[model samples]
Target: SIKEKPSSKAEKEDENPGTVRILLLGAAESGKTTLLSQIRMLYKQTFTESELIHRRAYVYNHIVSSMKAILAFASANDLQLSLDNQQRAKEILSIEECLGPFTQQEYDAIENLWKDPAVQEAYKKRGNFNLNDSAK
Candidate 1:
């Protein structure tokens, strides 16, 4: 009879000589960070205050970068936005000038701009680039 393969834990120990190593590889924005966060939650149970703070910063960065990309795409395509949305985009881009946290109203305004149909259409065009079908 053929022998069964060893358990993953046993195979890892054998390969690393007592040290287990996991390597995750993927393209950009391919859910690597999300996967790592899930794994961390499963194995570590909870995050420290500092880790939570760092995660918050990462989320904020993603939001800001996404906003910037949307604005850039709109401008490049000469896509017209409503006066309100235009003002909101300006406010979002000038957050550094205020040197303060965003108010709830400002956050709502940004979210609204992001949900605009024109913006969504523009985002769909991005599927022509490197983004995979799932990401699109």
Candidate 2:
């Protein structure tokens, strides 16, 4: 085997920089878009800042933005549940899953569930999330 020596600043500069990739997923108006904006801005990256800010502003103006309070409540409850994990991110969620792709039964169940007093109470107490373990 050949020995390799560490490089100096000029040598390091000759090499290309590493790349990082992130993926965002959510419904329309979810903060996936907003978060991406904040990330690019906070990084002070060499990109089109005005365009990004304009798009983020448009999302806020025309779409539902992130909810701060209900999300905090849900995070607190989830923390209390002791789900400490590094493999996955800590999430503040919404119940878009409950609506699913919409079978007739799921659609009817959704309409009925929305009117449920208990469901409303749960939403207020915790963040909106589907409690049902199995979703089709």
Clashes of each: 0, 0
lDDT of 2 at 23: 79
Residue pairs with backbone overlap in model 2:
none
Alpha-carbon lDDT of model 1: 0.70
- Root-mean-square deviation of every model: 8.6, 15.0
lDDT of 2 by residue, 1-136 (tens): 9855647865555454664566798975466866886887798865577775665555332211122232344455653322221111122123232211434543454444434443344455542453321111
lDDT by residue (tens digit), candidate 1, 21-93: 6788997877787898898888886888987877777666666666667777777787777887888888777
Distance (Å) between predicted and true CA of 78, model 2?
A: 40
Against the true structure, candidate 2 reaches a TM-score of 0.28
- Give the least accurate 10-residue stretch of model 1, judged by summed lDDT: 127-136
Q: List candidate 1 segments past 4 Å from native.
A: 1-30, 96-101, 128-136
User: What TM-score do all the candidates reach, one by one?
Assistant: 0.64, 0.28
Candidate 2 Cα errors over 4 Å, as ranges:
1-17, 46-136
The lDDT per prediction is 0.70, 0.42
